[model samples]
Target: MLNHFVRVTGLSQSAQMGALPASYAATSPNAQGGKYYGPDGVGNGALGGYPKLIDPHHNKVVADKSQWAKLWEISEKMTGVKFDI
Candidate 1:
């Protein structure tokens, strides 16, 4: 898994986008906000990743840090891994 991550990190932005579903590719901002790929994935953005920063219940980004923490804790338990801050 780590090797795959490393390999993907080395890919150019267009190459990386080629592997994504249309919806995911579309969600990745261009000049509008911030692109979520390349060396600095999700640079200057809070809501980009494989699982993405979403609230399933609301079907949107979690609006508050406390709520995000709650979701993060649940995900940590499920995955048995804590994300790096």
Candidate 2:
């Protein structure tokens, strides 16, 4: 699992592969604005080991923090939730 995490961290930080556009995301400045997004996967796509991990079609595992961070960045594109990490 440690190795997988390491791989994920690498993929998440890559500029072309995992780094996602987070500036354009709609943010919730509202402290009491209520929850706008859910806590589940929203089916967003991009370069990541997520599909590789969850998708049966993918036959490899990459558990990395940076990699997951990048995946979260892309998810922000769709959900408009910027990860504090």
Best by lDDT: 1
Instruction: Show pairs that collide, candidate 1.
Output: none
Q: Best candidate, TM-score-wise?
A: 1
lDDT, candidate 2, 1-85, per-residue tens? 8768867755333443332222112343422232222211233343232212133223233355676677777899989987675
**Candidate 1 lDDT by residue in tens digits, 42-73:** 64222223323322244345446688889889
True-structure RMSD, every candidate? 11.7, 15.1
The Cα RMSD of model 2 versus the native structure comes to 15.1
The runs of at least 3 residues in candidate 1 whose Cα sits more than 4 Å from the true structure, single-residue gaps closed, are: 1-31, 35-61
Please provide TM-scores, in order, for all candidate models, with all chains considered together. 0.32, 0.25
